[model samples]
Target: MKTGVMLSCLGIGVLGLTACGGAASSALDSYKPATVNTPEDAKRWAKNASAPNVYLSSTAVLGITGLNGQGQAEDTTCPKRNQDGNTLWLEGDCTDSEGRKWVGKARRESEAAGSDTGRFVYEGFGYEGTDTCGGKEIAGKWIFEGVVDVTGTEEEIHFDIDVRTDFTGPDEDADCAVSDESMAWDYTGTVVEDGSSKNTWSGSGRVGSSKIGVATVETKDEVIDMSVCDSEAISGTTTLTGGSDTVVITYDGATDCESSSTVQWSLNGEAKGELTGVSCASAGSAPAWALLAWPAVMLLWRRRSRDVRGGRGRRRI
Candidate 1:
């Protein structure tokens, strides 16, 4: 399928570089997706360059890129959690069970020996920058804080940039056939649960400046939310910027899980097509977002009330 779309959500800012030699140094092209950045001197020392308690959070992204005619991509992270009691950090293509996957494991250096730190090891599927077997390219870092639980009918999470991939390379790996490079975006999202098996997250994102010029995509409150579990499916819609366009998301499947869920997005109710892989995480494990808004009870209640009620609309998809 088309993996390029997946990179869109993960932030493909690794493009637009000026490489002098033909050596494929970074993890993506190395075929060693998982082990892209072992504890090298420069890279290792950079870890301590941040706060002590901050660990990386794991992310599993599956989506299509608009560039490569909406190609498909899946990415995950290893060592599900960090030493600082944080979840695993992730980068590109975590869902592929078969491919040049990046499996990360942390090791504890002896603290008595003037070192008691964790080091991550990336193991690629095959030797020579190629999975050979599954052809997967992966790279990214993780920094996480503990999960904060929201004390409401819904779950919420709070986090920061605990893990990030390197963004140093040519503007575009255009010749590679797949535009699967690091990209970035600046947007906000919200997830509302309409029912047990139905939920939706909608947000806006923009592209960062690399070799490729800056590109901004505004959803304009364009909500892409859905709930699909076992018996029934729910749908939702949000208007985008410029008011000329809108995306309507629909779910068709079960009511509690996302497996085999069919999500279709439409513009002004016109069927765009079937969206194969759509992954979005609006809140963190913790209710951090909720906690921050707690001080403003009136505001918090209003937002939560809208979420629940808005979910009930259930119009035709």
Candidate 2:
């Protein structure tokens, strides 16, 4: 499962650097994926990030650099709502049953509920970096944000999330094989109800790089449904197209409601053959990428919405 095609989206800027370290790093790598600077920082907090918020590819990647992914869980503070019940303020951390940890902070204006109808501005919600993790030299920042509509009824809801995430580095870990690289993605995405048993999701976005040297990604859209699943299980298919190439992942059995899913990865527009792990989990849990990645902001939307309906989205908030 060589699915590390993430470089195409964000970190491709570091591609040349990953190849010729010093020269490129001194020049292009000069841009160390900005941090929380000021209002001016808010102006460019998410600079160079784009995507439709649907696929598992890298938009801010520099190239394909596999590192020891997703780590242990930690406690977090996810907000329930602002003083006004309509405004769902996202500012916290959460560690799932799995050991994946996530921390996040919303921007000023765009950080809360967008409208009364239902809209959530996503922010970079990811893992807190460490100079060393499990004997690995892991240090980097992965953050994402965008607007999403999480308002819906009992069995159905509309999902339109514009996601932009920035992945900085594995910091050339000692224990884990990693490359010192970075990337970003800003794109659009949509999720619709197909029937009571299923839901359809799709999106399109662009990146400057790809593992296969391509630049576009199209999710002909994947279908997810738990019609036959239990409370702790989920099932679905992921149909994603990168540049001219496309791959699909089909969920045959039960998807652990707790974490990731190991599914069939195929390039023939059908999920078959090779086995791969994907990040498709329930709202409260973390996905594979997100397990260790930052900006678990989307969960903010899901959790907040649940809060609106008097559900558990705003647990511990």
Candidate 3:
């Protein structure tokens, strides 16, 4: 379905490039609906309307932290680092085999340098890059600031993150059919070693040229079991509203890591559709922009961790 294609294109920018083009058309700032006269109509509207949840998930926030849902660094492209007194500066450019390019810089300060216990604060961390996938080329930028606190002998870790992103691309289909396309969002969340997390997201943008107007995403406590799943919100609700029509999506909780989840969709207070299996974490999901954008920052942290703790890695708390 074009729903997956829309997500794949958005995923191309998660860790992507600079914003070089005009801002997405403001006309896409509000939802403009197609006629919904049948269950099929409601089904299509529900899928497209609820698609943004994929990008709004905690997984996307983790992408900004340069870590996957599994709390592992998956990107190998590292940015250059320079040590300046107690502060470490990272700046450089990297290109992946897929021809995606990333350029950015970040500043981090060590709270307790040369001590067995380590605490770091990341300031002014951001990057921009671009990638082409599923017949679309996306360019975007990401900016974030957070603190990583490590305490005790086991070196328990905890982090609070805030992130902002702006991405622009042609909203198109597999055949290269162009439509309205753009996305921008703000995401914030926290992850602890116990595999629990909470997130809140809000944004106004377009997916596959479809206007999302203003939307907010939220996940319940322990809704995403990091030990069992990779950033999928096994239980949560996302609401999208424009004019008098509204769409709501509910993700049914699961027990294991599954590619798809059971979801229910409703429009204007009426049930429209229910699907037993909906892919939410695959490479082709909406966070594909993150897959491409996060590597540069991920590489930076991987290098930093290697230089510290003598190869003993820090678990994401």
Candidate 4:
């Protein structure tokens, strides 16, 4: 999970390196325009963005809703909660086993079912005594717009999450060379009593000057059983569109017996990387895509600034 969050941040912060290479274009070109034309279109978008890892993603939100240290059992935290009418509000400070402190806030409808439905409003920020979450100072401020919709009955739970976040970047003096990222995620999923479900997710965002996107697009789907999420196999696949090019990746998650996952990536049906270690765990605040894009994003970051006809400096998205 740390890997996924860190790696995803790589895409988020590193994408800012506009001159990173044509790689960003190819890896994220599949996504469409930023605006939604209709409610149905928005619904479809929300559904897809919530896929890939429904249980984990939902749990991730749940952890944030309660500031439970991102659901890491080993972490210690103190939190405050309040209920008013149909809504519940939460705020808290938590310290991970490693002593990193996470502070976050979340508000949501108290009910989990029926037409009224459940939705969450969340904001989270983390910092060490200085910057501790990632070697790149991964712990910054994460703010969310849009509400996460909760559907289904007790026997089954479906989540429709469409989140747009404007991430606060670090100061000019920072250990991590990563840039600020503005991202939007639309995804949906349903988990049954058996802990099995189907999910489709997609996202597009800007990391500085670079643009990035990822989605299942029109691929054959898979039925995932979260309860049995022991890795060791190709868990899923998605097309990553960056800049102007696309890359296909087959993801293999961390087996119950292992600490890391691997990915097989290709472009035009040719292998891009074999046995690349990726963050496949579901225990950190980092998004999974970040882990998958780590190696490639770092390469893009190393490439440098975009070709600006006029001027260049950090501009907040």
Candidate 5:
């Protein structure tokens, strides 16, 4: 009888251990990390960074990405200037890192669609200090000021953006800012589906805010699927600020994630009005710890099960 009890106890212990292991695995799956759907979702970040609907941050990437203008994808860096109650003035030069560069100024209104509005301005520069086509000087700055409906969720964010661009210059000087160009967009985002700590974002928008007599404006919102979270550094993929009008830009500069913890940027999907990118990282260890506790619980359960089985077996024997 004693031998039978011992054997029963051993079997129960083995089963209990296995159960514990299973429990641990389950706990690990339930773990959740500190997540950010959009590292600096242009709208969300601007709201959080700006004041009470006065001036707001100038989204260089957002501005260019959502633009239905002509040219390849490139970076346009701007300098921070002064900010009045609801108006911000920024003056900077742009060097097309990967594409071409043009001089321009953009303004973002702090009000929603049906409320007050804002303005944006831009002036295209001559390539070699002179206009090429028809020897016509492309002068004057294109200006845009309008209202927008910006709405989105934690996992899925969307934007319905519309704006008007104009060009005006000396008609006799062969340079002018032409009005009648408009760009519109509809965007969507999905969180944490593409990678461990990343989200995929893409959207479509009209081109033109294009020139009337000039080339057609490519009205497509470029895909922006990028990992935009940075925990260790002050300046990385994501940046922080106090009010809406004050703008400070930074870079994530993380291309080779293996060498650096910083997340890199990439492009995905077709260019028919939208683009996408991915951001992923090593998951946190909290889940691993949670899973560790299950093994102990299962061991105890097995001991109890074995005791009950032994008692019944002995009584029958």
Candidate 6:
């Protein structure tokens, strides 16, 4: 009887050890790194990393108020304006350079009328009518709010602006597909006169019918010269986090404006590998908001070199 009882205890101990080992193996597998072993993986990482910068520059190009004819939207007419004590309300309609109609309403402090610093809170801003893209009418909306501060002389004016934008649209992937796919983004950033920006953005909803899950982008002192047709970030590092993966991109700050960037990726804090010669230009090419919003908003505040002392049209550094 004694020998039988000892054998039974030994069997229970072995079963427990087997179950524990299996559980540990599964947990380690879950922490495996993302696929970053090829140049293609680097390209994909670069694209996602630079997306926040594109969004930042595009939003700056939209300006504080779309009423500025210098912006992408032109021929703005505000038919209604009401002043109630310290608050001012405005409603207007405008046509973008692409012929798409936009109707928006805003409220600002009445004191901002003649001030160089103020805030404009957009109550409603987006496409007013059928806006077609890729032979199909696309529906989307932009919720934007900004504060603008201008200082210095007109000859050498300086601008500092803070902006927040939220966008929701069909996740057609620029193909004009008919599906329930949709994507949404919430981003906020700041732009200064020197064309340097910092941005933090998060994505939700879906990307082409597949849930984007948890994704975010954070940029640090990113500088871009949009005047250049093939512009990419000239300097700075952008960190992009998606699910269990993290990608870090560092721009070479090449004076020639070449698309020289490096991408390093990791998963769950495990270092995977790194790649060079990654092109960040693709960031502007196909962002989440690329289809209906970003293309029209493609512009940036021209950066002026501090050493160059001349008129507005002079050479930039």
Write down the lDDT of every candidate, Cα atoms only.
Answer: 0.23, 0.31, 0.35, 0.35, 0.22, 0.34
Estimate, for each residue in 126-189, the C-alpha lDDT of model 4 and write its tens digit: 2222232334444444333444556555445555544444434333233444456544434444
The alpha-carbon lDDT assigned to residue 117 of candidate 2 equals: 33
All candidates' TM-scores? 0.31, 0.43, 0.46, 0.48, 0.25, 0.46
Return the top candidate by TM-score: 4
Residue lDDT tens for model 2, 1-317: 11111121110010010222322122222333222222222111111111113323221210011111233122222222243444535454653222334457442222233432344344564433433434444544445444433344423333333434444443222233443332323334444554355445445443221111123334443455555442211344434443344454454445344233334456544434534223333223211121112222222111111110001121000
What is residue 304's positional error in candidate 3, in angstroms? 35
How far residue 264's Cα lies from its native spot in candidate 2, in Å, is: 5.2
Best-to-worst order by TM-score is 4, 6, 3, 2, 1, 5
- After the best TM-score superposition of candidate 6, give how far the Cα of residue 106 lies from its true spot, in angstroms: 2.5
lDDT of 3 by residue, 1-317 (tens): 11111222122111111122312223224435434334444333333333233232212423433432333433445444577776666554764332333355555454545432333333434444443444455554433333333233322222222222233332333343333333332322222223233322222332222333333333233244434455344555655444455666666555434455556667788886675333332222221112112222211101111111001122222
Residue by residue across 1-317, what tens digits does model 6's lDDT show?
Answer: 00000000000000001122222123222332334333454344345334333333323323323322223333234324577765666665655443434556665553334443233345444343233435555554444344333234312222233333334432223354332211222333332333233222221111110222223455565554454423455566656555555656555444545544444444445655655454333222221111122222211111111111000111111
Looking at model 1, residue 242 earns an lDDT score of: 17
State the local distance difference test value for candidate 5: 0.22
Candidates 2 and 5, the one with greater TM-score: 2
Backbone clashes per model, in order? 71, 50, 21, 38, 21, 0
Error of 5 at 134 (Å): 5.5
Cand. 4 Cα-lDDT: 0.35
lDDT of 6 at 128: 30
lDDT of 5 by residue, 187-254 (tens): 11111122243333222212111211111111111122234333211122222222222222222323
Q: Comparing candidate 1 with candidate 6, which one achieves the higher lDDT?
A: 6
- Greater lDDT among 2 and 6 belongs to 6
